[model samples]
Target: MSTHFEERSGVILCRTSWGSWYQTMEEVFIEVNVPHGTSGKEVRCNLGSKHIELHVKGQEIFKGKLFGTTVSDEGTWTLEDKCLIRIVLMKTNREAGNCWASLLEGQYCADAWVQDQMQRKLTLERFHRENPGFDFSGAEISGNFAGGGPDFSNLQK
Candidate 1:
């Protein structure tokens, strides 16, 4: 019930049988490994607003609804090293600065540990944005800084 993802350069990368995927605030990157010597014509990908279907060498590698909406026109895929397929999807709501937990809907969600790290990273970024006077680049966030913990607004004697 849990998916393990590796964090690289502040981005959490989820690896699956098909391949691996990672996302930024504005784009989603997908890498699919194909058979050696597989040509570009052997790979077919369809990226819609919320749907994705990829085929390699006539084999269905992945097909499902995306977890978030994207600009279909901006989505692109290219074959690399004659065997790997790299895809880039531009998120439609880039201005909102939201992170996607998974590539496909109801699939590959981040585990508790990953989720916590993501929460902390997002919180740190928000803090830096709101308070630009101070440098919080190296600050580490501990505990439940996102609220829902015990409230101590009023201390009792």
Candidate 2:
């Protein structure tokens, strides 16, 4: 069965957990969420190097490979609330222009960022394992960050 998901308004009302991406200079953030009334216990999200799978209510809503220039499986996932999750896909190239054009046909090690991200993920995992019960909370959960130069069009250049 195929996962059916789409974005409408600021909500992620889904019959299946599909996804949508909005990109920046350095990352692609894919939004996934379960339909209203679906409890957190009823949802599962598997984030991989080249694909992501989201399941809810014991049925898979999303299971698809990702694509793009220099896409790293080394992304981050966070529960926006009790009903939503955000996946952060890092960009390998700073000047690749827009990468949201393609996101379903690529290899994990196809880019240098893959290596870097692998290391990063491993480090984070190790840290968490070593510091069991340590809370890294209160950090910037928002994935939006620097992607390129800031435009000061209203001011004098």
- In lDDT terms, which candidate is top? 1
lDDT of 2 by residue, 21-96 (tens): 4444456566766566667677677766667777778997656776654454567767666666677777666332
Backbone clash total, candidate 2: 4
lDDT per residue for candidate 1 within 66-136, as digits (tens), equals 98899999999999999889999988975323667778888867666765665555555555544556555
Q: List per-prediction Cα lDDT, in the order shown.
A: 0.71, 0.47
Residue 62 in candidate 2, Cα distance off native in Å:
1.9
Q: Count backbone clashes in candidate 1.
A: 0
- Please give the lDDT score for candidate 1: 0.71
